[model samples]
Target: MAKKRKVVDAKRDKNGNITDVLLEGNKNFTSTEKALGMTKSGLIDLVVVKRKDKEHLRTRPDGKKGNNLDEMADD
Candidate 1:
């Protein structure tokens, strides 16, 4: 059997905050959050989307569905 190696997907900022995260490969922010039992505001930072990217990485809250950031920004 081949041994699987652990991957370091994210690195913390100098302030100890999660500066960046990798959605590809072995780890991601949300996965790490759930694993560490991190709830509330701490999780917000993990939820991110690239404005110029065509795909919406996350879904909007109830009643806010079908609206993109630009559409929502107008309100």
Candidate 2:
């Protein structure tokens, strides 16, 4: 059986170009492609990289502490 596709509520600006999209899927790609209106199988054709989106994933300002520890002077 095929997976159910969710009804995506896409957001657009005054120019009518799609800007933001909301869908139900993985924290990875399915939701992203759906929001971008790509075929479900299309996302699998290419590599989907999962990078840390500090702005979206960061819950606190010090989330980068571990990464910056070496570069930043200890206080």
Candidate 3:
């Protein structure tokens, strides 16, 4: 099986929300749609959630809170 990808870094806006995430050694920011697609394909080690008619990306049920996208911005 192929290795799963991870968002090692991220770019945030003024509100501190993640706008784009860095995939390992990627130079360009990954789009949300692309990330969602990857999540569906199981390429990325994250979860996809649909809420309020929109799709949101989040980490799996891991014990580490910092691994979550929201906290990844801070770290």
Candidate 4:
């Protein structure tokens, strides 16, 4: 299989919060902004969430649906 490529290179502030994101590959900030209908700076608000209330979200008996694909789709 071919190795996966990194899609974003993040720049963080002094507090370690991401302030900017440089998209990898052929896409530039202008192109991404145009396509996404928003400025590149708008993407800085992206958050990573961890559910502390629930051990897991999925309730499938087989446990196959708890994988990464299912989690990503929920986002």
Q: Using lDDT as the measure, which candidate wins?
A: 3
- TM-score for predicted model 1 compared with the true structure: 0.23
- RMSD to the hidden true structure, all candidates: 14.0, 15.4, 1.8, 12.7
lDDT of 2 at 65: 50
Summarize candidate 2's per-residue lDDT along 1-75 as a digit string, tens digits.
455343223344476433443334534322333433343344222123346851111112455554221222122
- Candidate 2, lDDT over the whole model: 0.33
Give the whole-model CA lDDT for all candidates, comma-separated. Answer: 0.35, 0.33, 0.81, 0.33
Q: What's the lDDT for residue 32 in model 4?
A: 24
How would you encode candidate 1's per-residue C-alpha lDDT over 1-75 as one tens digit per residue? 223222224445456444333333434453434423222223322233446743122323446533432332231
Q: Look at candidate 3 and give me any clashing residue pairs.
A: none
For TM-score, the strongest prediction is 3
Off by over 4 Å in 1: 1-8, 25-75
Q: For each candidate, give its TM-score against the true structure.
A: 0.23, 0.29, 0.81, 0.27
Ranking according to TM-score, highest score first: 3, 2, 4, 1
- List candidate 4 stretches off by more than 4 Å: 1-6, 26-75
| Steric overlap count per candidate | 0, 0, 0, 0
lDDT of 3 at 48: 92
